[model samples]
Target: MPNSNPAHTSKYEESGVSQTGAETALGHLLKHVLPTRQFNTQFPVKADIGYFANVIDLGNGQGVALCTDGVGTKMRVAELLNQYDTIGIDCVAMNVNDLICIGARPISMVDYIACSHIEAHVFDQLGQGLAEGARQAGISISGGEISQIGEIITGIDLIGAALGHIHLDRINTGQHIQPGNLILGLAASGVHSNGLTLARRVLLGETPEMQQERVHQYESALDRTLGAELLEPTRIYVQPVLEMFEAGIDLKALVHITGGGLLNLLRVQTQNIRFVIDPVPDVPPVFSLIQQRGDITDAEMYEVFNMGVGFCIVVEHANDAEAVQKICKQHSISCHGIGYVETTDAGHNEVVVPSKNLIGSGSRFSAA
Candidate 1:
């Protein structure tokens, strides 16, 4: 049977090390391996901005919008590849996708662009990509800010806020998540704009010849260059999800798997629920290559990257699941039954990996 323990033997294991020492090293690694914090600390909740924004009753419905995310080191990749068009799409996808997590239908977005010196072509590409992304998400680019600080800025920084509206009665805030609720995964569009720091460290660290060779290998394997593959526009699911809700399907919870990966599911507020992801979707070729090349552990990969599945919706165990799946299929998107929820300690939380091994397994009852 696969080892239930989170610790796994690595290629670097030495024969002379004592079991206790090995266990200590493994434990230390695990401690830093997973994201300890609940969410991204960089994106703080802004209460002051809401003072002047237009208000919609959304009648009893929660305005489940998220002002989360930044372009991160992906900008460097775009700079290196001399491609600025797609990064704007990523900026929009990063925030709008989070808005949909709580069953919010994205209505409008505003971007923040910071640059030391803005070139005309760069601005044009960014604008084009943002327009394309907004069109795909069925939202409007209401307004945005472009700050020019010759000293404070470097290349370019792109971030945005997405506004979404959901009926209070229709929001999937995980309140309905029960022990038997099914976890459905929506496949990602290649990396969906996270974990580039590690990818650059691992894949781009080789010699020039090695870099070219690696890129070629990735293209052959994944049918796209490593740089292009990593920059694939983020999948926008706002319309599909909103349509599902409009059709009267009861989605229990929705999760946008970003920097925290599958662990993001923990952000949902439902009592006594534990998630068991027994059959995760296959990891895309790019991720497999990175994992094999860097010798990254499963826990580390999930913590740092979205793997293959970008978005997930927790739904009831009724025939409506088929209807939801059909809608996703009509959009040419793939879905999978990743796992189910179970009643555990009142506030205790657990994420059981496929090997029956618990990684971010811990008790949240005290905090809850």
Candidate 2:
């Protein structure tokens, strides 16, 4: 089991991102934002305020799932490496992956790009990446806006809102997730889009010159330059997941393990259950490099980065788990039954990664 540190500032906070701060700030924001849900009764909101995605009842027994996300400090890597092509894929993956959690089949997206200055090559590369991502997700880029707000914007900002379709009755609100269900983890391509701030601060360096020196160096374990590894595009799980939906697999819950790591599993609507992840997959090489370089704790690493799993699916029966694995394998995604959901004596929900001796609740993970 991993050792626990005493209460103090986490290394991630030192990197300039605060998980607790964000939660508090978000609460204040939601206080103002959630009331707007009553503004339009014709298309009532289907999901609650903070599921992976929100669906709007469109009448006629249909719902449209929608979500918006952007590439975070991972964009800094693109700016540093002069690579602007792949992050569009990251932007797309971030939004669409969330939509799938609600069992929506993505159909279209609109993008918004804000940059300090208009650079022709950068825009061209971004378009190429967006086109490719849309192709992979089987969605169309309906429209977009590009703005040159030099005073307000820095290098660049890429964000998109994705829309997907689902039958009102078919929305997977995770209400069906039960104690006997299994948790299946899907492989991540690399770091994905989360935790890059800490990753950069640790692996590259805090100073610009130091980061420049390190980003270009070849890493033997990665077999590529450090910047390239960091810039790797996020994997889009739409096809395989949609196939599972089409196969009549009882997907009780779908989780996109993003900024909160394994703790994202708690977003499911189920109650009085804890997810216990044992026999977790091996940590990928890039994450290992970050941990060793940063001297980060196991609890912190699992709470920040994906470690290895990018996505998780909850299914009621063992046979359903096997069917999910088969579908993912056919799609070339490595899937494993890493854990099981169990009834918890504690009233609140939790995520327990036993190998690391860590337990997570609400917004953060602590050493057990």
Candidate 3:
């Protein structure tokens, strides 16, 4: 259990991330941007603004799923460690994982790199990482752009847009998730490119010099340098998920648990239901270390980080849940039945974790 001391300021906000603030800004931005669907009536958007990915109907019973994501502050870890290789994989994982939520087969991606300087060796390493990520996702790096703006970008920024193919008839909008459906959790590999701002502040110290010194220091708890642990690339779930699709498993909702933790479960298309996570997967050591060191509350930890589970799959039948676990097993990814859904008339969705005494509404979680 994490510390529930209210005396502690919101750890994530103290680390300079305001989830509520971001949501408020996004709400305002979407009100103006979401209306752009009228701009192209021929290929209108299929998914709403807040879904993992947006699908655009392309006619002929086909649709294209599109999403964009970046490595976020995880890139700073790479910069401090001077290891650019795995960060590109994080970039690809972040984008393609979202694309798969809509039951889309990721086909291709285009990367955008903005850097203060164009060093050949760094670019080569980033390219290698991208290639490895593409291979893992079974997608192509069809194109990219590099901007050398020394004044604006001190180190580098890596972002990408992924486009995937989905049969218009088979798009998963979570409309099928219902009462009695089980939630399956896939294990995460370390932090997986989120909450780094808070993580760094907690584990490695706040200042750059302190972080630089601590990054190379080994702790018995992790049995590795902090930098190495933090640098673990985001796991690419493309193969296992696509295999599950091919195996005829009906995945009602596919969730990439990035940044928002379990609260992300409420982002599905289903409404007026409550997700009850009774038995969360074992808390990974790294996350525990962060919580202990930061004196962060359990609610704050789950709100900002993946904690242990990185991805979630919702299935209606017990056999389908078993199949999901088996598929994940074959891929060497750990899976568990963490919770179930129940129909509710509360007029809004909620995520309840009984073990933690936490219930989530909107973007944040609080003690029950």
Task: Give each model a TM-score.
Answer: 0.79, 0.98, 0.98
| Candidate 2 stretches greater than 4 Å from native | 1-3
Off by over 4 Å in 3: 1-3
In every candidate, how many clashes are there? Answer: 3, 0, 0
- lDDT per residue as tens, model 3, 258-349: 98998888889988999999787899889999989888898888888998899999999999999999989999999999999998877899
True lDDT of residue 268, candidate 2: 85
lDDT of 1 at 227: 76
Query: For residues 224-246, what per-residue lDDT tens digits would candidate 2 score against the true structure?
Result: 99999999999999999999988
- lDDT tens readout by residue for model 1, 262-363: 877877766667887879788899888777777766666676678898888888865767878888998999988888888777455666665524455431
Between the candidate structures 1 and 2, which one is better when assessed by TM-score?
Answer: 2
TM-score of 2: 0.98
Candidates in order: C-alpha RMSD to true structure: 8.5, 1.3, 1.2
Model 2, residue pairs in steric clash:
none
Worst 10 residues of 3 by lDDT: 1-10
Supply the global lDDT for candidate 3: 0.92
